[model samples]
Target: MKKSILFASALLASSMLFADSLKLEGTIAQIYDNNKTLLIDSIYGGQMAIKVLPNTEIEMDDCGIFGTDKDGTFKDLKVGNFLE
Candidate 1:
């Protein structure tokens, strides 16, 4: 019974984590001039951008696509956006 309870708790925890994971889907709202990035507005009013590989679909958890630089200059990102 203890083993079963632990397994169930683990499953529930994983499910909650998965639920918080971001899943975005929409058209390319904007694309940077560098030809390496694009913005996407999700159907639920959230927006973010992922690094592009010429003509590939956007994905989450891809580091180095957005954020600020050492000198505080924003990197590959614009206003009115979030990091999903």
Candidate 2:
């Protein structure tokens, strides 16, 4: 049998290393499209499984030399991408 771990976004707040509304920096380790969840490997030496809810606000930043910033959707997320 396979066991799946679910990480609720709310837990970040009460984490010993995190404060309320703390921003997380990490790389996208895995993407579960069917459930709209992402497994992230944090630079802080931790992993997080975040589920994307329907009302969750999403955004992508423009770090390219000449790219413009724009709104983003879950479909735009990819493995190996760095996020903050």
Candidate 3:
């Protein structure tokens, strides 16, 4: 009975990890479109890789390059750009 209860609780915890929303706040490091992975300079520490979903939204503001305003997109994001 105890073993069964522990297994049930473990299953429940694992399922919740997969179901919860994941948010990563950081700066852009490297973007791999083919692999659908984004590398970020995480505020928590060094860089980390986060998976990108089809529904993920990337927003950019106050972006300028050498005095030219720029919008952030998959193609426009650079090494120094911020991501959340």
Candidate-wise lDDT, in order = 0.60, 0.84, 0.75
Q: Could you tell which candidate, 2 or 3, scores higher by lDDT? A: 2
Give one digit per residue, the lDDT tens place, for model 3 in 1-84.
Answer: 999999999999998998757566788788887877779999888889878676766565653665554444566667777776
Candidate 2 lDDT over residue span 1-84, tens digit each = 122223444454458555555788899999999999999999999999989998877788897997777888999999998988
Better of 2 and 3 by TM-score: 2
Task: Give TM-scores for every candidate, taking all chains together and pairing residue i with residue i.
Answer: 0.35, 0.68, 0.56
lDDT measured at residue 51 in model 2 versus the true structure, 0 to 100? 94
Query: Where in model 3 is the C-alpha error above 4 Å?
Result: 1-23, 63-72
Model 1 residue 46 CA deviation (Å) reads: 1.7
Off by over 4 Å in 1: 1-22, 54-84
RMSD of each predicted structure: 12.5, 9.1, 5.2
lDDT of 1 by residue, 1-84 (tens): 999999999999999989857576565677676756668886677766667564443233334657433322224445444434
TM-score of 1: 0.35
lDDT of 3 at 41: 92
